[model samples]
Target: MKTTKRVIVLAVLLAAVVSGCGEVTVESETTSTGSASEEKSAVAEKSEEASKASDSEVKAEEPTAEESAAEQPAAEEPADTATLGEKNALASAQNYLRFAPFSAQGLREQLEFEGYSSEEVQYAVEHIDADWNEQALKSAQNYLRFAPFSAQGLREQLEFEGYTSEEAQYAIDHCDADWNEQAAKSAQNYLSLMPFSKQELIDQLIFEGYTREQAEYGVSAAGY
Candidate 1:
């Protein structure tokens, strides 16, 4: 764009210089000799030809897409037609996402709880950029960081947090946990709170969504 502008400015100056020479030749034509007058006329003609050639050169040098866009007039700003309530809802949604992950349904419900109308909540959820699968994955990782859960247990927790069934399953599939290890961790957590016989502890692990093999492995690994 800058290069295009410089070329245009140089072309204009060249035209101006040629116009000045023509003006000088006009005065010389009145007082100069025939040969001298003819000489000046020839110089003026050459100058006019050079100016035309310069213009053609300038026209042949096509502007790039960016340069052509620069030549266009500034566009007007798009109107902000959203209501104040809707704007607030959008702002609130953004703030929530910055601090924590939220599914579309979860965010909509949160906005509604904050007193935003259905229209505002709808606008917020539509406009806010959230990948619900990512949100579910984050929730699963967060839960596992502080507590242990079997795969099914974690999926249930994500669903309770308003993720869809598909999103919950997606999180479970991608969470990358060994069910037996999670069951073992859960067993350890349970034992930290109180004592349990080996069979009783296995039953407890199963109740918390671990498979039978996973539950038995957990209880045996607990040194029972």
Candidate 2:
């Protein structure tokens, strides 16, 4: 009977040990599964946070509409209010220059005659492109075509036409005219208009700005 009892106790202990081992194994497996699920959750959360951070950085890198507009170039400014007047004056000056050569003073006078203000006339004259010496030369040529002129007479006439003394002298120096011939022509023109004594012709030529030697040459050449 004791042997039978011992065997029954030992069998019960063995079954208990097996059941405890089974419980321990099931608990360990459940713990490992829960840990793996937690790990996966943590990794997914980290990936989502990184994605969100990347999106935020991209948004920060891009400029807004207002900032983009500010970065563009500004528009050009308008022209000055007096620009039209200046242009008109410049055009008028150019047109005047195209028609005839003029001294600076003469051009200013012409502009003034056209009813422009003194300031505007001065501006036009200052801005016009012309060589005063060349203008003087042209004036001299024009005068010689219509009438004879002594060197001094021509220079005076040029000065009267608004050329500076220096400019008038330049024209006279470059005219390539023969003063004796000019004096002779003047004498002839005077004789054609009315008869005159030799002394009277000579005196008249002198009064007309001829030198003494030129006057004598003119009277002698005219058979006086």
Candidate 3:
């Protein structure tokens, strides 16, 4: 009976140890599973934070192509209008000069107030083809027809009308005017009304810008 009791106690002790070992293994497995779950949750949270940061950076940088184009032309249109107006003024000034031949300097000042470029004004002046000599002759003829003038007086008038010295001289030389005859007729007409001395007549003619020889010839021919 003693031997049988000892065997039964040994079997009971073995069974208890096996049960304890099984319980320990189960607890270890549970702890490992909990640790894995915690690590997965932490990784997922980190991934979400990184994705949010990337989205925020993309939103903060760079405008859209349409927005960029709109900003550029909104600033450029007014500048283009200013440039176009300037060009139009210069072109108009040039076209106007074709009908009226103004002096280069005179036209330049007029065009400047009208907003023309200096180069455009210069180009218009250089391209004019008006006959200055013919203009001078016509001017001389007009003065002689309206107001009787001596050669020197007519020269002054032509000069005032913007004719060059050579051009004025040419017009005076070419006109069909007889200076001596004209002077005699004037002197006779004056002496007919108011009897003037020979010296007084000469002085009057000279004061009218006649040459000394022309005045003397005129007085003698007038029988004064």
Candidate 4:
């Protein structure tokens, strides 16, 4: 009876040791799984925060539509200080210059004739970008195209048109006119108007500012 009692005690002790080992294994497995899950959740939160920061940085670097428009240059505005009368005077002078060339004084006269005051006329002339010498040249050419003129006559005509003496002389020097030919053309025109003998035509040409030699050449060319 003692031997059977000792054998039962040994079996009870072995069962207690096995039960304790099984409980320790189950607790260790549960602790490891919980630690792994916590680390995964922290990493997911960190990744999401970093993604949000990156999106914010991208938005900050871009310019808005309003800012882009502000960077453009503004257009220049027209001057508003001119009076209505001055504006109209300037416009009229510009239109006249566009169609025909004129001396400074001639332009002033035309503006005055249009009933602009002296002050307004002066303003228009001052603002006009005219080369008086060039205008004189153009006027001389226009006269020649319509009718023949001696160099002296052309110079006088330019002066009468309100060109300065210096400007008139410049036109005369550059007119490229052949005096003999001009006298001849004048003689022909006179003959077309009325008959004349050679002496009478030559005298007429001489009276019209041609040299004696030029007048004789003109009468000869007119078949006198």
Best by TM-score, which number? 1
Question: Residues 1-224, candidate 4, lDDT per residue (tens digit)?
Answer: 99999999988998999999999999999999999999999999999999999999999998899998898788889777766787788899999988987999899899999999888787788777788898898888889999998887888888999999999998888878899999999999999999998899989998888999999999999896
Worst 10 residues of 4 by lDDT: 78-87
The residue pairs found clashing in candidate 2 are none
Winner on TM-score (1 vs 4): 1
Most lDDT-accurate candidate:
1
Query: Model 2 — TM-score against the truth?
Result: 0.61
lDDT of 3: 0.74
lDDT of candidate 3 at residue 12, scale 0 to 100: 96
Stretch of 10 with least lDDT, candidate 1? 26-35
What does candidate 3's lDDT look like per residue over 20-52, in tens digits?
A: 999999999999999999999999999999999
**What does candidate 1's lDDT look like per residue over 1-224, in tens digits?**
99999999999999999999999998787657777878999999999999999999998897989999999999999998999999999999999999998888899899999999999999999888788999999989889889889988898889989999999999999988888888888899899999998989999999999999999998887787
TM-score for all predictions? 0.66, 0.61, 0.43, 0.62
List lDDT for all candidates, in order. 0.91, 0.89, 0.74, 0.89
Candidate 2 local lDDT, 39-155, one digit each (tens): 999999999999999999999999999999999999989865544555566578789778776778888787777777777776666666678999899889889888999999999
